[model samples]
Each structure stands twice: as structure tokens, then as C-alpha cells.
Target: MIKKITIVAGISVVLLATACKTKDLKMNAAQKETVSNKKEVVYQVFTRLFGNKNTSNKPWGTFEENGVGKFNDFTDTALQEIKDLGVTYIWYTGVPHHALIRDYTAIGISNDDPDVVKGRAGSPYAVKDYYNVNPDLAVNPANRLQEFEALIARTHQAGLKVIIDIVPNHIARKYEGKNNPKNVTDFGANDDVTVEYKRDNNFYYIPNKHFEVPDTEKALNGEENPLIDGKFEEYPAKWTGNGSRLAKPDRNDWYETVKVNYGIRPDGSKDFPELPAGFDTKSYKEHFDFWKGKDVPDSWKKFKDIALYWTDKGVDGFRYDMAEMVPYEFWSYMNSAIKVKNPNAFLLAEVYNPNEYRNYIRLGKMDYLYDKVETYDKLKDVIRGKSLPDGLSDIQNGMADIEHHMLHFLDNHDEQRLASPEFAGTPEKGKPLMVVSTTISTSPTMIYFGQEVGEAGNENAGFGTHSRTSIFDYVGVPNHQRWMNGGKFDGGQLSQSEKDLRDFYKRLLNFSLKSAALMGKYQEIQTVNRHETQGYDSGIYAFLRWSDTEKLLVVTNFSWLTTSNFEIKIPSYIMQKWNLKDGNYTLTDQLYHKSAIQLQVLNGVGKAHITIAPSESFIYQL
Candidate 1:
């Protein structure tokens, strides 16, 4: 469900790039404006793996063989520590009930057959029940929901908001809601199974077809075939999660789950109300009122109810998976209802169609969308030594108008790690990337739990591959395990290198939260330096962020092997904006306040010479 968005003609188009090179970023002149607001930071932790300490590394091992983290693992002390790192929100991944292979049937939850599941632990996306939490995350197993509720209260008490996943695009192959609210019906419960498409039906049906599993020979399996018993029963094969029409899909297809129908007919015409042409500029309140008295399709009400249900339960927000796969109208309906309930609720989506960015944000009422296709992908190319440092200005300039709505991140559950062999193989490279992403704009920044400690994610789990940590199979994150220090949540066992990395993250993030200029205005000085300043390498970058009370110059070193020392020239126009005089002034690095750079200004122009280490970053306050 990872997508790349490119803005063209004020419309978001799906920009597919096999390599790191993406389309040049662009935005309407009217949309490009400097932002000023409090910076937000989101910390995403895969709930099942965050506190797991098992070191056996056995493939397809039992839950005991590879331990799982409990909701209680996020103790008051741990929450404070994470809050101390400057996080405003915590996205608890894999919280909903999914089809895991573990036998919870004895406790009213059913087991999933390995023949249809991806891993021994199954997938967090293969949701079995929408109203319940994952039982594996609770010590009592039966009290999972209570544990999660308590975690939410604790997180709020720590001054951090909570966000969880709402995979509206699909559900598990064995969808059932044993604990659905009274008067609520199960999916496909009141549907006419004979029809292929129905406005009220929860799923699309292949009336006469029977379900056939993927070929066992091609699928990733355990040491022994866990499906030897051979009975996975499902009548009338439904569409696969990726919209695969085949009764039997390939192993590479998303065969573990089925796609949820959202009133679109087989011919691609929608059965729902379409937003008016100028609705893209409408507010959520307008969108909400438009649907208040209208009778919508059944699937629309179903999802809207699910979202409002969670909102009533005090869940602050949701990170929607594969948002564009579902129709834009559906999001407009569901998200508007959510806003009506909790206007401050955070709604982030994975909408990759760059053309649809505005539609989703305005019409669909999404608060933020992933900026991976531009900022993140560009950063990756620079880190890998494949792209020039003509730099991210164009990308930022392109996205400046909507920069605040573009969520930036170096690593998440779906991407490769910073230190993975397949990506950049050093943690230090993230230092410069983080500085630019956090300081350049008002966009929120997110970091996976072990990213700071440099978790390589090189384990051979059953269904998941290396380069990205296993979300399907239970396993330990070695580097993070060191930082965990066996539930003490202390860095007592961390190596010197890991300790240094964590400290760098702490200082930079804390500064981002506390800085006034970062949220005020942004001006790129990198290109100016490369053209005017002597000894300015193409690999070096610089920018300016300021407010009436504070002005700061930022420099980043992206060189893989070279240490950079250069005379960075501040242009006359920039000097005039800051009202500089012809004199000498001391500019000190925010990260290392005592370290100083002397600036010489003559006739409203300034120049400073400083040496920066490889992969280092500095925020010099003027």
C-alpha cells in the first residue's frame, strides 16, 4: 500500500518510480507560503515487537520461542522517557484483532489456517475482528481491550496523544465479529450472496466460485508445513485484498485478506455521491453538513460508524492504510463524521496519488499524508550517493504550499532501515536527513522505535524478509534489545556507538520542539552558497529559519567520505531581511552551543567559514 504522490496541475497523480528518481516536485504559486506553528513528532512502535526480548532468532517459532510485547510494556516510566525525546504522539501499530495462527479459539477467538495466512503469526493487516484488540498483547489474553484502554490513558497522562491503524480498505479472509456491539451486524451478515455487487453488501462475491489457496510450493512456509491438516474452508471466493479477481492467487498477491467493497460497481462507476467540482476547497464542517441528511450507501455508514466508535472510546486518531484504494467520497463521508465528533483528531493517510492530494485533504478531510515519494525518497537517493545535492529545495519549493500537511519520516514499518545493507548502511547518514526534515518545514516527523539505535532488521523470520523488521513473525530487535536493557527501559546495555546515536536524536528533536524560528519561516541558502561562496561543495547544504525574536542558519553535510570546510556566504537579500549591520558577530551551533562560527558582514552581506564532519548537521543561531 506504499504510494508516491506527485503534484501536477494542482492535481495529485500516481507517480510510480522503480528507482529513487521521482518526478520533479511542483506546486501552485498560491500554495507556497512559509509556515509558523508548533512542531509535532510521532513515535511509531510495532506493538507486538516493541518489548519482545527473545534472542533465539528461530524462524516460524512459537510465541514463546519469540516473545511478544505486552501493552503494559509501555509503562509510565517508558512513556515519560519517550515523551522526553520530544514526541507529541505515539502510533501503536498492530493493536486490532487479526488472524494470527495462535489458538485463541478456546477463549472465543478462532485460529487461522496457515494455508491462507502469510506467516506463522499471520499479518496484522489480516484483521479478524474490528471491535477487539490483539489478544497476544495482553498478559491475561482475555483482558486485551482493558490493557489497551489503560495504555491510552497512560499515554494521555504523559502528554502524548495515541494513534492506531484503521485498515478500512480490507479485512481478513475469515471475517467475523464475535464481540460486535449489540444491534450491529457482522460483515456479509445481511447481504444477498447471489449478487456480485450490492450497495449494502460488505464484500464482493464470486457467486459460483469456490476459494482455492495459493500453491504451497511457492509460498514461504515453516520448517514443516503448518497446514498439513489441510482444511481451510471458504465458500464463493471473494476478491483478494489487492483486487485480484482470480480464485487462486499467486504467493506474491495479498491473498491473506479480502478487499472491502465501497459501493463501486464492477464497471468502475461509483454508487455513492460524488463531491462537487469545487468541493476541493470546502471545509470539513461543510463536508460534514452535506452528508448529515443524505442517505448514503451501506458500506459508507459501516466504516463511518467504526471510526466514530473509536473516537467515542477516546482514541485520538487513526493512520489509514491504502487510503486511495478506497474511493475519495467514502473518506469524505467517514472522516467528516470523525471531525464532527473530534475536530482535533489526527487523520493521516497513505494516499500516493499526487493528483489526489488536495482532494483528499480538502474534500476527503485528511489532516496529513505521507511525503515519502518526495522528501523521503530524495533523502534516500542523496544518502545512497545516487543523487546530486542540487538539493531538496526544488522538492520543498514544490511542496511548500502544502508542506505542513506532508508527513515526513526516514523509517517506518514498510521501509528499509537506515543501516540495512539494501539501503544506506550507516546510522550516521540519518543525522543530516533528520536535521533537514525536522527543521525545513512545519510537516510532522515520525521515527520507528529502533531507528535511533540503528536496528538493521536482518532477521530471517518466517514470512517477512530482511531489510525491514518482521511484523508478521515474532522476533527480537537486537540493537533495540540493548537499549531496552531487559524492561528497565534504560540504555544501560547500549554500546558507545548506539548511545551516541540516541543522544544525537534526543538533542535534535528536543531543539525542534523548542525552537521558535523553525515554525516561523524557511528560506533556502544552499543554492546561493554553491554559487557565491568559495569552497562550497555540491554535497553541502544550508538554509535559514527565523521569526521576529529568533534567526538561525542551518548547515548539513551529506558527504559520504569527505569532511567539509567552506566559506558560506549569506546573500545581501537575506542579510537585508535579517537587518544585518557591517560588523562581526558570533553564530553558535544549537546542538553544541559553545562551538562558535564568526560571521563577517559588510554592506548587508555576510560570510562565515566553518568545518563540518561527514554526515554531520548544525543549527547556527544568529
Candidate 2:
């Protein structure tokens, strides 16, 4: 019989027959104050592709033909231009050395087989070496670490913090840590190969089972490669990254990577020591102290060291990939260590499970998590005309307790481009959506590199298809290259429409960055207006944000080709909160500053007569 593990509400996780438990955590006043400060804007750029100027986008192209961007390309001039976009932090994605098809055998780096690697440039998530930088991103392969360090120094000089990816759930199929510290060793190096599960084992082995690559005839998709031999050498196959226990994982599985064992046996019972009750309410320093002399899993210590190693190297933050896959206890151990090193390190996580949000944030010590499943997905549906904007209220109200810990973004590497035919079909459609997303809360905002200028991402770059930028293949982002303008870092080649779109982003981002009301109190006025006003509907959304001195009334029209002219009514409850009297006030559109309207307050109820253009958004201040 298969044993099932159940997590009890408001208590702890029942690990089958074990006495382990995970306690819930609440956000303290200090953490709340930290999030309520200035709205930090994070600009996520694919580091290897950000400064690449080549436009020859050949399918399945080699690194020589489709030249890669070097670390030196992020010059002071280029970084300053990015900083001028109101970006407080720059997430340089794909910095760690991962498995790729390129040859570095001359420098003692083994060539990765093309059969296991995703594309000419391997997936950034399948990291091979956590200690070193990607050789392909350096002008000289041997000096990759120095090049990255120089880039880090340059980034700091330009007045911006740096963030990089730390994928802890799994690692590349073939692990090679050539530049690891002498004290640290490779994962699974000291493990016993014959056992299925052990408390100290780094990996769960299959005993006598030998590994076999997936049996997919279209593995290469007709691309000719000399290394496509349909075989890899593994004595006893370990589990796949996606938790496949079979000796051969399916083609769709994360076959290029292997899962790391964190003292969780094959039967779902934890072998390591669990946290004591009420650890969730403790500070990171307390959490770090709790693990001082306790015996923990090998993988936990290894990942913690890796994080501290980078933190010591001057990295300001980390973006943990697929954080939910790892145990909650491990994050408490890992993130607490990071905090002890740098108290202000920006620790962002990718957690999709809504039930575990509090667990990761309060218990795991994560600073921010991706608000994709709630805010981003719902907004995308509204933008695509698949749903009404009425449901957005439910999402915001539901996350009221942890709203500030959620990070909002309209575009990222994993999602389809806003301008692509598969998405909104035009860059202009994102304007209203972006306004609602960025101003709706106290959460930080993130934007992909090409999102500002409308990169459609419609290219067939080998292993990747249209509608999303290729992270696996060696390809130049065409629309992004136009903004690059041959390393000038100016939008010299952008069309008039593209230029206008970028200008819109610059204006909105800067405004959000400086606005104090955005990080203050929020109340939804859309529901009240839809019932009391004549023309307000589900297609239009309205809200109010207020601080002690500043008051803002935000409205957005989600309908395309349909203009909205209505008397937006603000409830008496909000009017009392803003402490407004029964009098006339001038309401000016903060964006574009094109028009000012009359806001008449009568009987403690404020009413604004406004006209919102199709797909237009307004941030009106009193």
C-alpha cells in the first residue's frame, strides 16, 4: 500500500508515520514596514542575450554564427541607460555555468553531449556548475569568473543592485564544478551507489538499474548533430528532476537534470530533523541559530554554502527557481544563512501553490514571490478578452494579508510576449494592463528587457517555437536588438510606435517609483461605481490609494475600441478615510497630464465626471 502525507490546516505537515511538523508564520511589523517603503522596480534581462547585437537569427545556429553577448557588453553607459528606466535592481538571468553543446575541452571543461542538452545554448535552469559563470558569456572562457565580477562592480557603480538565478531543485545530468572551493565538493560524489535511500545520501539510487536516455526518434527534430547517439553512461540511474523514479524519464520530463535529495525518502517521509513549533514567527537570526549544531541533510548544507558563496561575491539578491519543489525546512535553512550574510538581500522565489505562500514567506524567510497564478494570470485573461475584470477584486482582497510580499509583472522569459499574436496582438493593449498591475498594490514590479519596446518574440529558434523568446537556442531577439541599436544602447532603430510605447513605460515606471500613495492604503471602488453609476461596467475598473498627504484615484478601461464616459462614484467610506469635505476639487490625470476634470463632493460622497479612452488608464490626484 502507498502511504500518503497530509498537511493539517493551522498546524503542521503529517509526514506519514513521522512526528514532523511545519508551523505557520505571520508577517511581523518590521517586515511589513520594509515592504511598504519605495516600490522597488526589478528589470529582468537575459544576461547572455541582453547586449548581443547580432541579427543573424538562424535556426539551430552555432555560437560562432549567432554570436553571444559578453559580460563586458554591459558597459557603464548601457547600465546607466537601464537605471534611468527607474529600475532599482537588475535581474541578470543565466549567469551560472550550465550545460551547453559548445566545446571547452582545451580548458579542462568537458563538452556536454547534445543529446542531453536542450539546444546549442542549454536551458539556464539546467545549471551544471553553481560555483562558476557560463563560459559562453565571457570573451575569454578561462576568465569567465573575473568577467562576471567586473560586471557586478560596474552594475554597482551604475547605482543598481544585482539579482541572479539560483535553481536549487535540481542540477544538470552531468555535474562538473571545476571552480568550486577546495573545501566544498561536488554533489553525490561521496554517496553509496547501491542504496535506494539513505539519510546522508546526496541522491536516491535505483540499486542495479542502469540509466537510458529517452527513446524519442525526433529527439533532435531533424537537426544534424554528431553527439546524438541516443545513449548516456550512468551506472545506477537516480531520480529525474521532475521526480520520475524510473530508470528512463520521458522526453517531456526534465531529462537533462537530476533531482537532489534533501533527506526526504522515496516514501515521502522526511529523514532529517523538523523545525520546532513557532519557528515561523522567529527572525532569520533566530532561525540561523536554531540550526547551529543540528544534523541536517547534505543537500541543504551544500545549497546554503552556494548561496553564501555568491552573497560574499557581492550579489545583492537571488531569484530561486521552482522553490515549491523543495521542502519548506530547507529554505528556512538556506535563506536564513543568506540573511545573516546580507540582511537586505532581495530574496525572490517562484512558488505557484497558493496554499504554500505563507509557508514560503513567513516560514521559509523568502522576501518576495511571483504573483503569477493570481494577479498575472487573471490580468492576462482580461487582456486577452477571455474574462471580465470583476474577478481581479477577489484576488487582491484574498491576498490582503500578504499583498506586499507578492511581486507583480506583465511579462517575463517564461511567459509569451505581450505584443505577440498569441497574446494581446499589439503592444498598445498592455498599457492599461500594466497600469493596473503596477499601481494595484505595494508589491514590487518587474519587467522583461524587451517588454518596454514591444518584442513580439515570434522567432523559430531551433528547439523553441514562436510566441516566447528562446532560452535554449542560440538566437538573437530581433525587436530587442532594435533597442540595442548595435551596442549604442539607444533606441536608434525603433519605429515611431515602438518609441511611443517605450516612452509610456518610462513615464509610468518613474511615476510609480516616486509615488508614496502606491505603498500606502488601497481600497477597491470598482464594485461601488458599477452599481451606483450609469456607465460603469465589468470592463472598467477603479480603485483608490491614499497616504497621509497624497490621494490617488486610479481607473482603467479594459475594452478595446470602446470609450467609457461615466461619473465614477467614490464611496462615502473612502471619502471619510481621505477626510474630504463636501466641496469641489480639481482632479488631474497624472499620466500624460493632458486633462483636468471636476471632482464634486456632495453629502460626503465624491463623484468624478471622466472620459477614459479605449484601453486607457488614469491616475488622478486630488
Candidate 3:
């Protein structure tokens, strides 16, 4: 009988039974669970593909000119293109109504912002309405449901799930409804205010009668009239009632967003003259309820449903923008709603350094956050020949942490593209490194739209649309172009370098998909002298990842100029299982397909000595 043990809290408990039946049974159950939760691969795309640009295909700049808005056009071609890539999930960024009535300084055109513009109306992030889709996106208004159903069907047909972007932090400032600046109502009385509001315990409002100030001055400065003796005062500062000076909090300089009053005065002061007792706090909900339909309570509900609407339309998951800034309660509600809609829906939050904020995992919330510290900062240093402080031990610990949770990517829309030489090294040298780092990391990988093609630009330090490279340009301008090239117009073909990178990524992605060791849950297997070879003092890095069925040893020679020979002993379990002699094994180069086993005696001990090339990596499978 096989011995069985129950492992809980990372501890194995042996039930002191003479029989091993229970232990074997529990181990089998654990293995089954592990196999069932294998990680999946996701591909991201910007949805401008389904729309057209007026400048390139003039006269038909609107949806009418391009037959792409219909489901047949996208499903027939676009779906097939993505499906061929062998990705399991697709994340579509922003397909909602981003129309705004701002004057276009570029073309001097003044109208409700058209969906088609030459750098006129930028990205879908500038959403004007949460309840509707951009007219250009859905050509026949009546066919919205039909288009969604078809898109979903095609995506399912292609064997991929879909995810959409959900922005809940703020709405476009151009909205002119009941929530607009003009419709000044009782402050904090109705929850349906158009502007974003907060409900912390520190907010207070001045009465109109408390002070006197010019309208222009009042407009420039966000000050309201004061209330004196329950009457509006001409000047707020001159109010003679038992009131305190209104204070605003000092805003942080790093963030570009306006801060909402967390129910507090800016100056950290509390309400001085209290309002009448028994004031209904339920009135707070009214501000958020603005523009909400009969069944919906607020714009967030509509926004949440819009996310589901896209998932229902054939998108698999969401990459939630500014997920941390949104109220946790809202995320909880959204996750629950999504679970009911689709249990398999994958949610990836754009949170930076989640290890610092573990609260994001509190039940039924964001499933994945960008693992910035370990993947980007630490791992990048190791790859780029920088000495690690904790050395190889840190790499092992980092991989262990990554294995416990869902981690997304190193490069995203908000940051500089990974293809940039600064991050990846010049394309020639960096492409190989990028492949090594991304594939070897413990988490499932994510590559931005143009990352596969060596696209480069820094959007982080104020680089705009004009500065960034376009993937559409590389693939040759599809008849339906959604990108703006040089001269502020669309239709630019891809350069030769872009094509090379795209092909390289195609190979890397396919290889990753085919590897069971990459997709399956990983266990860290011990290698002899693990502390010495993977020393905290030495810059050398090595680790082993094993599935329940197979094992792979990864070793990276971190030095850029020095070629060193390191002796390693294979673990007894691994050596015995692989039918090796004297507990010794040789390293092999997976990239070059070469065997690297050479036996030698070091310090009177038999060890497998292998020479490493400068800045090289090796993988041996047993």
C-alpha cells in the first residue's frame, strides 16, 4: 500500500496509520486539483480595429465608409487572425462611447466629438457616457445585440475568451447633464451629483449666504457661498455665524487626478456648526444615482454591466484601470456580478506592487495584479547584469511568491513598452533576454499589442500619441485602419524591424504554450549546494521547477564578461528517478540544443562540472 499524508498549511501530517491507503488517496486528490488549475495564456488588443479613420479612407471616415463595424467583418477575419496565435484569452481595451463636445484645435472643427479624428478624439479612455457605445463602434444601432452575439460566437469559435477594460475612477468633465456644474443643488444632499464624490467622515459644505465674492473669482477658486443664520451670505469669509474657516487638503503632486472630499474639509477640520439631528444619510446615494436607469442605482452599476456586456459580447475578462483607487466595495460588487455572469471570467487588475497591498485579494475581488516589485524591478536587474542584493535566494523567493497568486506583466499601456532598449537592451541583444525572462518567470505572461514587434516609445514621461510606434503600421495597414501615423493621419505600413520582432514573438508564444512545465503548477526541487551555487553572496542564479510528472533545471550565468565553471550535484530523488549514476547530471543548452555534461573531481568530491558562456542560460530536463 502507498503511504498517504494530508498536507495543509504547507505541513504534511502523517496519521500514524500502519496502512498507507489514506496518504495515497489524499496525494491523488491534491494532484488532481493541481492539474485542474493550470494557468492560461491571454492576448491583449486595442479595439480601434473595429472602426475606421476618416483621413486615410476619406469621405467614409464614419462607420458607413468602412464595412468593419458589422460583426461579419470582424468575426470572419480578425477572429481568425487572433485564434491562429493560440492565445486562450483576449483583452479588448475600451469599446464604449468616448464622444465629447470639445472643440478640435487641430482641425478647427467644433461639434460633438466624432469617433473618427486625426489625433482629434484620442483614446477610448476619454469616455463621455457610461451607458452607450460609440456610434462608430456599433454601425446599425438596432444590430447592437446581434453584433455582440456574433462577436462572442466567433471568439468562442476561435477557442479564446474575451475581456474588456472598465474605468470607474472618473467620468469625462464635458458631460452637461443634471450632474453638470450649472445645476447647483443642495451640497451633498442628493447622491446623484454628476461629479465624483466621497463619503468619508470629514466632509463639510459652506452655505451660500456666508460670504461675498465675484462670480469670476468664485469660478477660478473652488469656493462656495457661506451660510449665515440659515441664510445665504454675500461673502463667505465675512460670515458672522458660529462657523469655522473652510480648509482644503493639500493635494499630492504625483497624481494628475483631482481629489474627492472624503467627507472632510481640506484643512483636516470637522463640521463646526452641526446640522439638525436625524439628517438622512441615505441622501448620499442620490449623487451616484444620477443618469441611472430604473433598475440601476448609479453609473458604476451601468459601467459594471457594460463590462459584462462586453464579456457577453464575446470578450473573456477585464483589465480594470486604476483598480486600487476605486472603492473596494465597488470591486466586490463587480466581482460578484461577474461570477454570476461567467464563472470562468478572468480579471486582471492594473495594480502596481500588490505585495505591498495584500488586501486586494480579499474574497471575490481582483484575481490578478501586476507584480511590479518582483517581476519588473528585481528580475529586470538580474537579466540586465546588475548584482542582486539577496542574490539567487531572492530569485527563488520571488518565484515562490509569484506561484502563490496571479501576476500579469512587466510592460503595459501606462508604462514604456518593453521593446525599448532601456528595458530590453537594443532589439538584437534584448529580444533573447526578453524571451528568457518572460518565459521563465512563474506567472502567466502578458505582452502588449506592439511588444511582439520590437516597438519602442516612452509614454511614461509625457510622450503622446505622436511619439509611440504603431503595430498596425508593421502588419501593413489593414483596409480598415484605426491608427494615426506621422502627419497626424492613418495608414502607415510596418517597418522591416517590426516584422522580425513579430515573428520572434510568434515563436516564443508558441513555445510557451507547448511547455507543460511553464503552464502547470511548479514545485521547487533542491539541487546540491543550492545555497552555495545559488549563493546570496554570488551573483549566479539557478532554480528548478518540476511538475508532478517532469522536472526542469534552470541556471543563468549572470556575468556579462566572465565565463565560469560551476560544479553541481543532482538531488538523490531526481538522480534515482532519472536512472542517473552516482547522483550526477549534466546541464544542456536548450537554446542551442547541446549537451553540456563533463565529470570532474572538485575538493575530492565527484561533481558535474559545466562551463557557462558569458551572460548565458541553460535548462536541463530529466
Kindly give the number of clashing pairs for every candidate: 7, 0, 41
Which residue segments of model 1 deviate by more than 4 Å?
1-36, 216-231
Error of 2 at 404 (Å): 0.7
Q: Summarize candidate 2's per-residue lDDT along 1-622 as a digit string, tens digits.
A: 2222211101000000111122112347535423436799999999888878878888888787877888998999889989998889999999999999888999889988777788779999999999999999999989999999999999999999999999999999898988789888899988988898887777778889988898664544656667778888887998889889889999888889998899988889988878898877788888889889989988898999899999999999999999999988999899888888888899999999999998998788889999999999987777676777777889988998788899999889899987887877788877777888888888899999999999989888888868999898888988778988988888999999888888888888888898877776677877778888998755677776666657777777776665667887888876776677899887666766766688888999988777766555555555
Q: Could you arrange the candidates by TM-score from highest to lowest?
A: 2, 1, 3
If scored against the real structure, what TM-score would every candidate get?
Answer: 0.92, 0.94, 0.61
Best by TM-score: 2
Better-scoring candidate (TM-score), 2 or 3? 2
Model 3 CA lDDT for position 501: 48
Off by more than 4 A, model 2: 1-26, 33-36, 217-224
Among all windows of 10 consecutive residues in model 1, the one with the lowest summed lDDT is 8-17
Q: Rate the local accuracy (lDDT) of all candidates.
A: 0.78, 0.82, 0.42
RMSD, one per candidate, in order? 6.9, 8.5, 13.0
Model 1 scores a C-alpha lDDT of 0.78
